[model samples]
Target: MTLLTALLNGAVALSTAKIPAKRQSLIILILLIIASANSFLHLWFSEASEHSTNIFVTIIASGIVLSNRAHWTASILFNWVGWITISVWLELALIQHFFFAMAMSTLLSWFAHLARKKLVTKQIELEIERDLAIQHELEAKAATETKSAFLANMSHEIRTPMNGVIGMIELVSQTELNTDQKNYLATAKRSADSLLIIINDILDFSKIEVGELTIEFVEFDLEQFFEELIHDQHFHARKKGLTLALSKGDFHHRHVVGDPYRITQIMNNLLSNAIKFTESGGITVHYDLVTLGDNLQLKVEIKDTGIGVSETALPFLFDSFSQADTSTTRKFGGTGLGLSITKQLCELMNGDISVKSQLNQGSTFSFSVRLKPPRQTHKMASKPPVPVSFEGLQVLLVEDNEINQEVMLAILKGLDVNVFIANDGLEALATLSHSQRLKFDLILMDCQMPNLDGYEATRRIRAGEAGEIFSHIPIAALTANVMDSERVKCIEAGMNEYLTKPVKIEALKSVLVKYHKQAPAQH
Candidate 1:
């Protein structure tokens, strides 16, 4: 009887172990058979009637299973089996052991519940982190969009007034004046030019930040270009009492395919920096052509006898919005973006810029660019003189700002062209519709205006909504939107050309000359 009772207790202990469900069920059945035999033995044998030992063993086994398994399902099965054995043995006095087993099971279940709760909390935390990351991304995107819109609006608003001021200054400078009046005009022009530079730098930096700057390759005469560039720099050098020199090596080829506008901008920036820093010594620009196995490289170097960069500052010389130090910026007066922009442009051209400098002696900036040689040699054409008169040319100048309108009026008056003004796109269309006797030769359309924008107006004109007579009229977009995307938009809307403000007289006249040739031959 004792052996059978021990077997029953051992089976109950193994019940909560990590055995398969079927194996566990077989063990439980054996335990029940042992219990039934023990009950029969107790009924058949007087010694087996003493059930105290069996009750004690069953209670201890139940407690062991509940503590080790720590799972509510296993604990319930153990408690049910223990109670059934006790009842079948008719041991109602051992019911006290059931209460003790239930208490131990409750304690173990509480701990298991806590572990599950901790897991859930950890999962919630991860979910919150993921949500926060998405929110932050959305906020950053919104902020970037807002910044772009603000910059676009500011570009147009500020350049409109600047055009009037700069245009008036250029006109005043052309008039005959005494030495003192000429100096005054020169100073005013310089200040205005400086402001324009700041504006340009900000716009360029923004474009670079947004990855919107692009490069263009076309045929250009490098020799002629350098000659003109040096000529312009000469005036600035003379003002500082410095000599500007250019040295050219043997040229096996003359015309090459590259972005001449970007090249000129980079050279201009380097020259301007040299001039700004140098006190007395001269600036020399040297370039040579090198032939590689299958490619030609143009190596250009600019050496300036100026206050050179210190060793520590050299590393960060090309860093944006940073100068050699606070003192250099305070004395030199610049936004410290020129060299950074220059370096980036060189890299974009598949080249790189390096600098060699000594504290007080000089600095030399050199870069080499690989360019493809043109199949046919191209000679630089002599620039045609600015039109002295546009006697019979009729131009429609569409502008909303009063000051801008006045500026365009003065410029057109100098060209001796009949000028017609419109305040907005709506007015421009209305004017063209009513004017059957006098057809416009060209339209200088501003992109941003009230009632309707220049893009929409151009669309209407191209769609023949403004009458078939106006459909073929050459229209040029004039605005302060310097972005390349804006230029593409203008072209897509049927504008023949794009001009950015503040517009110069030379650029305006050049555009007229270009399209004037294509204009229908006047009767």
Candidate 2:
């Protein structure tokens, strides 16, 4: 009888545990029948031998503990103690003692299965959440990359033409013209300059959005840099018939190590806003330096006696694409990105910016940037190498665009340079490889061109494809791509210098002077 009970309970436990929960009904039913049979046999055996070893109860309990659904049913069947178990009263000869032990076994097994099921469900839910978070992060990253690429492409397309427009106009303006014609040209120039500023602002904003904006730290004369900057903005203030002055605070050091360009940008934004918003009186620029052992903090304040910001608007003044009001934007013609860019630039330099003002009285805009004294006192004590004369200097202007070529040629010619044109990289390579061609003093290579690009041409040049005589020729990238990543690529391609298009005369001249000084003496 004990063996029969063992076999029946064991079969039910094994079958139910192995079968799918949804497909375990047959197995469950068998479990119910086995529980009933076990109950009756346990009672009969208990009566036949009052000194029974309780082996039947032990076998039933083992089966209950070993199987999942079967144990759960058996637990319930034993007065809902397991999933499905028989009532002790259902036994024709119920033995209270034997039934008590069987009941206890199913109850314990049922509780264990219940706790385990809860744990498995919770684990599955956590895994699902983790997967969803990962998917979202990946999607966001892809979206940011796509936006950055789009901005880069658009910047190249737009700047390429802007380079031509501004360059050509400057060339035309240099020629003889009447006062009226000059006035028209001056207005055109101002309009072009404003347009360029807007384009630059948008590009800068895009770079900041993607965390691609890089800050460069180099030794520079801080006082001189700001002095020149204020001098430049003085014209705008003078045009408005307002006063402008700078109080150059006593400095601990004349030269400090920091990102001078970004500092200039921050100052430009604040001072421009102060000038633009002011209607009466004047603006004063104040600066001070604080020494912090290993670092220096340069603080600047721009005070303007102009229209001030409303209390409501002051909070969001530094937020991207925001201004005092929409009407303010309509009156002040700006992308509302300048202040936002300034705020971020300050933070990048481990500094901060703030403004205090009321509606009509005026506002004081203050910002600070951290720097450090040069490790060597005279690291940048000397000014940059002065540009030499452009007379008789030779340059190979490798460009595909005719309009761009015309603009570059006019500028180069104005500088009295001997300019040679190569329509594409392949042509530039062919020109240099020729034994009879003029040994070019410098190669002003354009990056993107048909047939072959400048990068490959430069690599080949460096690899002796253009003969060892010209292989060491100074190559400067003169392209429309303005991203820093693009500059890195140009350097990797063996170019020594990078200058972007709509090339400024001074900038182009600087590059020319650099290579000319180092140019191999003509044969």
Most TM-score-accurate candidate: 2
Per-residue lDDT of model 1, residues 1-523, tens digit only: 5675577667656754567645665565556445545644453454343444443344344333322333434534554465456556665544464456545544554565455446545755886898998999888778766766677788888888889889889888878999999999989998999999889888878877766678887887779889999998999999999999999999777888888888888899999999999999899999987777666788899999999989999999999988988998888889989989888888888889999998998999998776777767657567788677887788899999888888889888888888999999999888988886677889999999999999999999888777888898899999987876788889999999888889988889998887566555632
TM-score of 2: 0.80
Clashes of 1: 0
lDDT of each: 0.78, 0.78
Q: Can you give the lDDT of residue 439 in candidate 1?
A: 72
User: Which ten-residue region of model 2 has the weakest summed lDDT?
Assistant: 79-88
Q: After superposition, how far is residue 40 of candidate 2 from its true place, in Å?
A: 22
- For residue 467, model 2's alpha carbon misses the true position, in angstroms, by 4.3
Clash pairs (backbone) in predicted model 1:
none
- Give me the runs in candidate 2 sitting further than 4 Å from their true place: 1-106, 379-381, 384-388, 435-437, 464-472, 521-523
Stretches of model 1 off by over 4 angstroms after superposition: 1-141, 291-295, 378-386, 520-523
Residue 302, model 2, lDDT? 90
- Candidate 1 at 520: error in angstroms? 4.5
